[model samples]
Target: MRAVVFDQFGAPDVLHVATIDRPEPAADEVLVKVKAVAVNHVDTFIRSGGFRTNLATPHVAGRDLVGTVVAVGEHVQSWQVGDAVWANSLGYDGRMGATAEYVVVPAERAYPLPAGIDPIQLVASVHSAATATIVLQSVMQAQAGQRLLIEGAAGNVGRKLIQLGHQRGLTVVTTSAPRDFERCQALGSTQTVNYAAGFESHFQLADQRFDHIIDTSGKVALATNLGLLKQGGQVTLITAPKTNQFTFPVRQFYTRQQRISGFVISHATQDQLATAAQWLNHAFAAGLLLDDQVSVQPFEAAAACHAQLEQGQDHGQRLVLVPSK
Candidate 1:
């Protein structure tokens, strides 16, 4: 099978196509014929040698995939041959990834595609969106009628969070540029604030304090956003960037009984992954997902993808490795 392989990670050039032996599945695994896969921000971070401390070298580096089951191991009875599957790599250990023509996934990690869902775009949205949903629910314990703010609302996870929050009856507020304002509103965000000016002022305009804040933007220098939190509210930091320190308001509020937490979807239980998947499937089925904003690229253009994402204008999440038209 041909795969975009890398022995030493440093740059886009390091990722190239190579013909390696196809993998057979273990007794509890299935061999998937990869149809399409999406790149997570973590994929770029790992490739640039940023995550070298945790993951070793010489690894296949994709996190999410959509594929069809060609063969299932003898021990795999939950899924049969020819089932359409998507990757839920949360429980899998090490770097067994989905960046190849074929991937061997434990039966537990392959989720069956829901009925009537687009098999191609399903994988593109499900993996990242699911991770975001479960992490928010676990970290924020968000309830309906509470004001929830999502940073980076135009991005993949943030958009899904907005939709999920609205569906659950929460008052969803998100920050995005002018171009994305209409789209964010359509996704169920009750309020759209432009990040270019600053978020703190807008929060005050709304006459509200956030019950939960999920920061998806790596930018953490904004202090006013912290003031938006009321007493007993929580701020969940997916990226606890060193540059973004706890401001005076956060410190004062901490003394007054407030909590701050962090969450990542790198690890998930089978039940969590399955539940998240179901939630995403429902949202997509309801026409609430905005994955079509993405540009689907060819597999061979994998190297160029790095440069495209480096531009970082948030053109939406782009998926690669599906056969080009």
Candidate 2:
């Protein structure tokens, strides 16, 4: 199998397409024939040695993929050969990944792909949609009719959050660059705050305090935003800060019962992934999730794609890699 492999972490130049042994399924896993996979920020982060987990040499570079099942392990009774499926890459913490002709995924992490759904669009939506769904459904416990604010809402996850908020009848407000204000509105954001000016700009236009706030941007101003949250409100941080520290209004936080939470999708349990997958499958079948903005490239162009992403050249579209023409 030819795969995008990296022996060391540094720049996109470290990645290359090379022949590697195809992976076999374990007792609880299934072997998938690769079709299309997505290149994500975490893939770049891990490739550049930014994550804390110890990396194994010759690591594969991809996170989410859609493909057909070629084989199943003895214990994998729920799936069989020829079932179309999609899954998050099991590539972190010394596990093998999906950027190859074949990859193995634990059965629980793989979800059935609905008929008539385009694999390219499905791959683009998997990671970001799942992350936003888990955060809104599980972490933030967002409710309909509540006011929710999303910071840095121009990215993939932020767009999904806006759509999900609208589907649930929540009033969704977001902070984004002026360039992305109209795009965010098209994705269902009720209000757009020009964060390029300042966070105060968001506060200025808000008519009411938010019940929940989700910060997709790593830069957080918890101290200044505490006043923007209503009593018993919550804030969810999707990314870590550079300084690895955060300061907030401790007195107000305690007095108003406000809460802060952070999580990485890499740590999601099987149930969480399943819940997200099921929702996405239904959404796709219902023609609800549209990812026409994604960019598709050849699998062998992994290195160039990573470079483009690092240079901010994607123009806010998810980049996907198809294994072949």
Candidate 3:
């Protein structure tokens, strides 16, 4: 098996493909012959040691994969030897990843892939779309006919939120660069605002308040944006400030009955992954999700992909890797 491994992570150059022994499935796990894997910002964070989690060195970098099951554990009764599956690899929890020819995933974490879906598109959706699902379906409990404002709408999770928001029948407004407005609109945003022009000057064209706001920008303050929400509206943060603590305005929060929460997909459980996988499978099968815009690269280009991601050059396209033959 050839895996992308980083012995001491500092830069993208530290990541390299190495031939290693293939891993076998445990009693509760399954071995997948890797087909495609998506590269995420979290992969960079973990590799560079910027994330808060403690990881073993020489880490195999990646989290989400689309693959075919080659072997299942003796106790695994639900899946078979030839099932096409997609999974969140749980890489942050010291689990092996899919940036290789093979990977071992906990049986509960892997889900059968929907037919007629592209492997690249399915892999792209797993990590980011799952987080959006958690925020909308679980945290916000968003309802149809509601309104949502998605901050940083052009990024990976932000793009998924727009599509997911539409699926839930929400009127979606998004923030992004002026150049990305059309792209956001094509993804189903009813309104798009360029935050670079000025956050306050451009965010809202109407006097309407949003029912829910999800901030993926990581730079916005909850205190500053609270007024944009309607009374009893919810705000969810996928990204936070450097300090991790935000200044909560008690008076405003109490007066408007606004609610706020933060979510990190790294902390997601096996059950959550299963739920997300099921939902995504249906979404892809229904023609709600497509692979036309996803970026494909050879698996060996992982390091170069990481560099482009770090410099903020790669946006608007979900990058997935196909294993090199």
Q: What are the TM-scores, per candidate, against the unseen true structure?
A: 0.89, 0.91, 0.90
> How well does candidate 3 score on lDDT at residue 181?
97
lDDT string, candidate 1, 221-309, tens digits: 54555577788877777776666566545467666577777766765666888777777777777765636555577667676776667
Q: Among all windows of ten consecutive residues in candidate 2, which has the lowest summed lDDT? A: 197-206
Q: What is the lDDT of residue 165 in candidate 3?
A: 90
Q: Pick the candidate with the highest TM-score.
A: 2
Sorted on TM-score, best first, the list reads: 2, 3, 1
> In candidate 2, how many Å is residue 224 off?
2.9
Instruction: Compute the lDDT of residue 31 as modeled in candidate 2.
Output: 93
Candidate 3 — what's its lDDT?
0.82
Stretches of model 2 off by over 4 angstroms after superposition: 54-58, 198-207, 240-246
Candidates in descending lDDT order: 2, 3, 1
Q: Write the per-residue lDDT of candidate 2 for residues 161-259, one digit (tens) a residue.
A: 988888878999999888989988988898888776466545747546999988887776776567788999988888867787878768889999999
- Name the candidate that leads on lDDT: 2
Question: For candidate 3, lDDT tens digit of each residue in 1-325?
Answer: 7888888868999889998888889998899999988899899998898885655344788888889999999999989999998888556776786688888888988888888777777787777778888788878889999999998888778888899899889999998888989989998999888776347555445576889998887777787678789899988888878788778689989888998887888876667767777777778888765633678888788999898888987865777888863
| Local accuracy by lDDT, each model | 0.74, 0.83, 0.82
In candidate 3, stretches whose alpha carbon ends up further than 4 angstroms from where it belongs are 52-58, 196-205, 241-248
At residue 38, candidate 3 shows an lDDT of 89
